[model samples]
Target: MDAGALAAALAAARRRTLSLFDALAAAGYDDPARLPRLSIVNPPLWELGHAAWFAEWFVLREATGSSPGEAGGASLLAQGDALFDSGRVAHAARWTLGLQPEVIKSYCGAVLKAILARLSHAPDDDAALYPYRLALAHEDMHGEALLYTLQTLGAAAPVEEDVADWPAAAGEIAFAGGAFQRGGDQSRGFVFDNEKTAALLTVAPLTIDAGLVSNAAYLRFVQDGGYDDPGHWSGAGRHWLAQQGRQAPRYWRRAGDDWTGIRFGRQVALDPAAPVRHVTLHEAEAWCRWAGRRLPREEEWEFAAHSGHPGFAWGQLWEWTASPFLPYPGFTPDRYREYSAPWFGSRQTLRGASFATAPRLRSPRYRNFFTPERDDIYAGFRSCAL
Candidate 1:
C-alpha cells in the first residue's frame, strides 16, 4: 500500500490496457458484429468504460461516502453508472451499448487522473490505500480478460518482444502428507475477500505432473474419441459435451495427419512442447480419466507451487484443479463484498497464472474461479497419481 509505488503500478496497468484496446481496434475487433454472444466476453469499448467506472466508484465515490450514480456525486461522467455498472447491465446488452471508443478513452483518462490526484495526498495506511489497490487489481484482471477476449474473437495476438522462453519441466514430483496452510496472507497486502481467513489443512501423499499437459499429449485423447465416450465424463460434463458438440480444445483443428490451432487469428501448426490451451475442466477431467490419472486438488497444487518443488513449472497457462470454488473455514467478505461470494458454489477453482497474466497480479496463493464449462480462457491442466 505504498501510495507512490501503487500509483506507478496503476499507471503502467492502464497503459497496457489501452495498448490492448489499440491493437484490437486496429484489427477491427472493435466492431460489435465480430464478437460472439458469450457471457464470458465483454465488448471492448464497454469493458474499457467499466474498468474506469469501477475505479471511480470505489476510489473516488464510495470511499468518500458519495453514492456512485447520484447527481452531484464524484463521478466525472454524467451517466457512468448507467453505462457501465456490471451488476445492473445485462451481458447480452453490452454489445449494443453504443459507447464510442474515444468517449470510453476519455472516461478512462479522467478516472485515472482523479485516482492519481487522490493518491498524491492519501495516507500510506492500509485503510487509505485499500480501495486504490482494489481498483488497480480490478484493472489488471480486466487487462487479462481483454487478452483472452482477443483469443476468443480470433484477433491478432499482441506482440510481446520481451517475453522470455520457458522450457517445460519434466517428470512427476512427489510430496509427503502434511498440514499446509490454504488462503492468502494478509500481511503480504491487498488480497481479495475469497482468499481471506487462511487455514491449515492436512494433505495426503501424492504425485503430480511437473508441468502442464502439452498439446501433443491432448491430441492422443482426441484421437482416442475421448469426447464420444461417457465413461470418462461426469454427468454434468457429459451434458456439456452434448451441448457444445466439441471434439477437442476450442481452437484446435485437424488436417490429414497434422493438427493446427488458431492463435491470435492466425492458424499455426501445433507445438508438441507447448502446454495445451483452451481446454475446459470437463475436458481436463476426461483426459485424466483416460490416462488413469486425476486432476490435482487445489491444496495439492498450492503445496507443490509454494514448496518450489524441482521441475514444477507454471505461469504458462491457468491450471485447472479438482477442487470446487468454496470459501475457507473462517471466510468473511471484505469491503468489496460482491467480488467472490456470488460465485462460490458453482465454479471450479483454477490455480497458477497464464502468460497473459500480469506479473504483479500473480502468485501461487491467488485463487481464480470459473465455471467448469469455460474453455475460452488460456487454461490447461495437470494430473496426479490415482
Candidate 2:
C-alpha cells in the first residue's frame, strides 16, 4: 500500500486497540490483580505500552531514526526497552511492573502521532512502508491477544457488532487431495514472514468435518472418560493433564449431569450445537481418538478451506491441526525478525480464524500457532477420517 493508505490503516488499527483498552480499563482489567501471571495473558497495562513501544521502535526509530530518545535514536519511552520489550520482559514479571493505564495510553497516543507524521513525508516504497505495515499488523495481532486475554480472565466477550451469522451445519467435505500450494502470496498485500516462501505439497485423499466439533459431540468424549483413559492421550498430553488437573475444556463446569461454560463472566448452559471451543490440541486429540477419528493435517485443512466445497465451514474458531509449526521451504525472515523464527518447532499449527480474529487476517493459508498445552485461546478442532 501507499504511504497515505498505510497511515489510514494504522490510524484505524490504533483506534480499535485504544477502544479495547478503554473497555478493559472500564472493567478494571488494568489492575494487576485481575490479570494473573499466566504465560498467555500479558498484563493489560504492559500490553498497551508494548504495542506503542513496538510502533515507535520500528516505524519512528528504526525506519526513520527521528523518534524521541537518547540522541533521538532510541525509544520515546525512557524505560521502554526494560518494560515493554517482550523479548526482554519475562511473562511473570509483567505483573510486577509499575505501569499505569493512563501513562500507557499517553505513550500509545504519542507513538501513533509520531508515526502518522513520519508517514506524511515518507516515500511509498517497500523500505518506507514495510515497517509501517508491520507495526499495524503487530498491533492487530495484539488486539486479538487482548480478546483472548479477556476470555482467559472470564471477562465479558467482546461485542461483535459486524459479525454476520455463520452457517451452523456443514457436514464433512470430501477432497481428492493432490499437489496444492501452501502458505500465502506476498504480492497480495502484507504477508507475515512465516507465511512467506509458499510451496507445493502433495496431499492424500481425506474427508474433513465441515463444521467444528460441537459441545454435544465433545461431551460424549468426556462422558466416556476420555480424559482419564490413558490410551486416548499422548504421553505429553497426559503429563499436561496431570499438571493442570484439567477435567474438561477450560471454563467448563459440570452441574450434576449437564455442563455449563463461563461466557463473558456469565454462566451459560453448553449449547449443544455450538462449536466446542477453548480446547487444547491434547484435548482435541483425545476427543478425536475417543470418536475414532483424527485431527486433519495442516495441509488438509488448508485444502478444505480453499476448495470451497459444500458443507465446508470455518472461521468460527481457530481449528487445531495435527501439524507442528515449522518454516516453509526456503523460508526467509521478514523485516520483523522476531515474529516467527523463535516459535518454529515448539508450537502446534492452528488454521482458519476465530470469531475474535480481524477479518483481514482470516485467510485460508494464514497459519496461527500456539503451544500444545494452551487452552485459553478461542480454539477448537474438526475430525478427519483416519
TM-score: which candidate is best?
1
- Show the colliding residue pairs in model 2: 156-264
- Position 66, candidate 2: lDDT: 19
Off by over 4 Å in 1: 64-72, 161-167
Question: Global lDDT for candidate 2?
Answer: 0.81
lDDT against the true structure, per candidate, is 0.84, 0.81
TM-score of each: 0.94, 0.91
lDDT accuracy of residue 332 in candidate 2: 81
User: Which lDDT value does model 1 have at 251?
Assistant: 88
